[model samples]
Target: MINDEDERFNSELDEWRKLPVFKQALVILHLVEHIIEGIHLDDPHPSTHYKLRLYERYTRQMMENALLIPSEIATADSTDLYDHKMENATIIRKAAKEIIADSKGLQASGYKEAEYLELLYDAVEEFRPLFAEWVQSFSTKNFIIDRWGLFNPPGVSYDDPVDTMSFDSKSFLRDLEDDWDDGDDDDLI
Candidate 1:
């Protein structure tokens, strides 16, 4: 009995697995960079801790995917691919540093923290077009567009609601215990 969230994640993973290895690496790197940027924005907002935790989880997952890319692309090696991979690593590192520095600066500015975060958000929004242009110069543009659905398919709203309703953790754990007690390992899969 898979839930909607599980199904959605499975679908995303399936799509991710279909990408060329290099594209898969780029997508994960891009997602990590974006998550780092988002984490910076949410760091000062206490009310956004849940969102921050989600970003951290995503970053960890992206890092795992990146670490797995070597095996995925074991047979594919070219000068161009090597250069692109090196360039992407450099870019991701630099972006992460910049985001961190910006967040630190905002924190130290003596301005109200929320106000500073709002300003930082505005700055990012203003520069989004330039960021898009920079992204277009990379091999990742198509991969990003495809994975993120930058262009909507029919009947899918960009503002689609996410499933956020929570369930009791204890109940879920008890159900798992009951399944195991019944000698049913099927649910473990």
Candidate 2:
């Protein structure tokens, strides 16, 4: 049996996939808004805090394809999708580079913590459109969305211990708050 947290995450992902494009976009935006607001209220150094750190971070960009239906037109195929995604990937790459470069500059100028926060927020915002486009171009090929490669990047963990169908009030906010780890281990990375 799946753990409670895992079930909740998977269940939520399934439901998220089931939502219509317009609705999905709204949901993503809403989640982003809350997360952004929470940045000021929550632990800024937490790994989960940066989940929306980029368009490529969690393959959230790939979710863009959730509403996409493959074209019935004869000319549409992988080549078309690839060409389109490549262009988008280019844009995503550019924005990512800009965010990184600017971040380094901000640090070099000795505005590390304070300015970095604002930069992080803007960088995340830059990713929104490219991510949405990715979702927009998404089409299932052999039953898989095009975002297959981009979903899981380095450092963003999706694994958890909750269930989707049944609410685990037991560990609900606990996991989100990550209250258990005491930082005694130095094996980070």
Candidate 3:
């Protein structure tokens, strides 16, 4: 038996889930920004650890989604699909950089905010290059169909099927192995 507020919140979450991946990433970025702002404002109840955890979770999600964009672009069936994926990729990258810059600014102030900003800076530094690599991997591709034909070309089937690229969760987890060493396990919550 859920209350009205809980039901409404769940309904909203369902709608939110339906949004495009980049939009979802933007929402997470905004959430991270808001949480940092709250910390700056000296909100007493949530504590630094709680806020840092939330920031980390949102940043991680954004990074993971951004990192997968190149594979998505590479596998797109049409130019329109590739263009859409590229647009989303650009948005996610810019948003990520913005968040990183914001965290850096906070860190530079030499105040209490620097402590939490350091956590964010560390997380962003660890994940930011992966997103950049994904973007770079796609930039050299010839997406214009009019200028050039498909990599497979029409009526040219190959003996070996090309494998579709996907997000590798194992590799992602391995990259973050150090962060998980603390065994805090609050991420399960």
Candidate 4:
């Protein structure tokens, strides 16, 4: 049977792939892959090892974060879509920053040259404006009040009173029962 999470992921993946920010994220991934191809840790120096490890970790994170963006986008429910989107945007931006920083670390250690790493940096630089535009498009209307100090929409705070709404368990169960009752008996057989 098809599950809701899978269905949501599939739908969001298609829409996300069409987004310019998503496309640029793919480009950054590609550049990361290409750059890593030339990175080597054969040197015996411990600092070189550390720098190479940091570069590897950040690049891997970039790939993982890019893949996670769609799932994060799909996780929106009745009250937290904006938070998820903002969180994912922060993830993307942090990945870009880490990639650039670690690449410089590698350059300082002579594992990779700044000139060659410039391409990867440039791709991430290009992704920034696209990411900003995508973030600006998120609406505050769909959000729940964030109790944590983080991820709240602008001018909102953790100290603000929680929303007074409460879930009606009886009504929710009634709806679920109605859905089950409406199912064709033949489907169970």
Candidate 5:
């Protein structure tokens, strides 16, 4: 059976696919594919092969990061979701940087063509502004008071008092057990 989460995931996938930023990411992925396709995976030298492998791994990670963006946006609106999306963006940025670095390494090692590296770099450069715009579109409102201090909006602090009481799972479970042990449970059925 298709459950709620599956439905939500499909919906979010559709939404993100239509986004210009996501489309730009896909173009980058296509460039990565071409770059990978041009690599000679059967290089005789082990170190050269390893460097090529690293380049492929970083490019694959970039693709995965792009795929994760939709799910990050699909998370329930809260400070937690904002934090998660920010974290994803950070990862994407790091991966893109790594890809460029690794491309240079591959070129220096004579394992990759300058043309492919330049193409990949150009694609990532094009993707950057779209990525920035997408990040700017995230809503900072609809967030709960972030108790950890890290994800809270500016002007909010972890030490700030809130009206809602914290939930006590142990106390709730104890009361539930007590109710189950009592004879009144018969009426609940």
Candidate 6:
């Protein structure tokens, strides 16, 4: 019997066309990079499969933030300078989808770092009259960690998530288990 998660993921992947083009692009591109980085053989390993499984767990998280462009811009209470990041994120996701669909798309175009750098060029080129000022605003600000692992100015304090590699086995052994609880309590007569 198929469970909820499998049913949901299968349905989503099957109905990928319904999602915004950019969003599909983002996720697909992310997966593509994952494959290239992990399964390309030159830098490949068995852990690639494991990492993909790990990535699947957080797949929905990216989709949740795709609309921040319109959301931030439309409902922004602050200046008009930096609202583009939201839209840029959306485009980045879209482009990623495109890249995933066809690696030859941008990689063939000589993008050094195909994931973020590919889109970064367009963003930089289209700057000014388009969004140069906003980009400048971001530059001037301090490097606060963004949800995407990039930096930002002091805005919200986000909890940096620790990866699996950070787990301390020794500490886990020392503190996480209390197996001595078979309390052979002496019920003295």
Q: lDDT of all predictions, in order shown?
A: 0.44, 0.39, 0.47, 0.65, 0.62, 0.38
What's the lDDT of the predicted structure labeled candidate 1? 0.44
Comparing 1 and 3 by TM-score, which wins?
A: 3
Q: What is the lDDT of residue 58 in candidate 2?
A: 26
Which residue pairs in model 1 clash with each other? none
If the candidates were sorted by their lDDT against the true structure, best first, what order would they fall in? 4, 5, 3, 1, 2, 6
lDDT tens readout by residue for model 3, 139-172: 3233222222333223333332333222344666
Whichever of 2 and 6 has more TM-score, that candidate is 2
The true-versus-predicted C-alpha distance at residue 167 of model 2, in Å, is 47
Output the number of the TM-score-best candidate: 4
lDDT string, candidate 4, 1-189, tens digits: 336656986886576557787777777767666667766677698786777677677556655654554444333222335766677667666767877776676566555456667887787788788778877888865555557768777877767765521334466799989967875645556
- How close is each model in CA RMSD to the real structure? 17.7, 21.3, 18.3, 4.7, 7.3, 17.5
User: TM-score rank, highest first?
Assistant: 4, 5, 3, 2, 1, 6
* Model 2: ten consecutive residues of lowest lDDT: 66-75
**How far out, in Å, is residue 47 in model 1?**
2.6
Show where candidate 2 strays beyond 4 Å: 1-81, 112-137, 140-189
33 Cα displacement, candidate 2 (Å): 16
Clash counts for the predictions, in order: 0, 14, 0, 0, 0, 9
Per-residue CA lDDT of candidate 5, range 20-106, in tens? Answer: 766776776676667667766665877866676776666566456545443443332222345455656666666666666766765
Instruction: Residues 43-145, candidate 2: write the lDDT tens digits.
Output: 4655534433532332232222211221211112223343344444444445444444544443443332554345445644554564556545654221212
Q: Evaluate model 4: give its TM-score.
A: 0.69
Estimate candidate 3's RMSD in Å.
Answer: 18.3
- lDDT tens digits by residue: candidate 1, 1-189: 447657986775555344344443454445444544554543567756755555455445445544444333332222123224334444543443454454545344322345535444454444344334433444421111112434333343445543211233466799978966875446558
Score candidate 2 by lDDT. 0.39
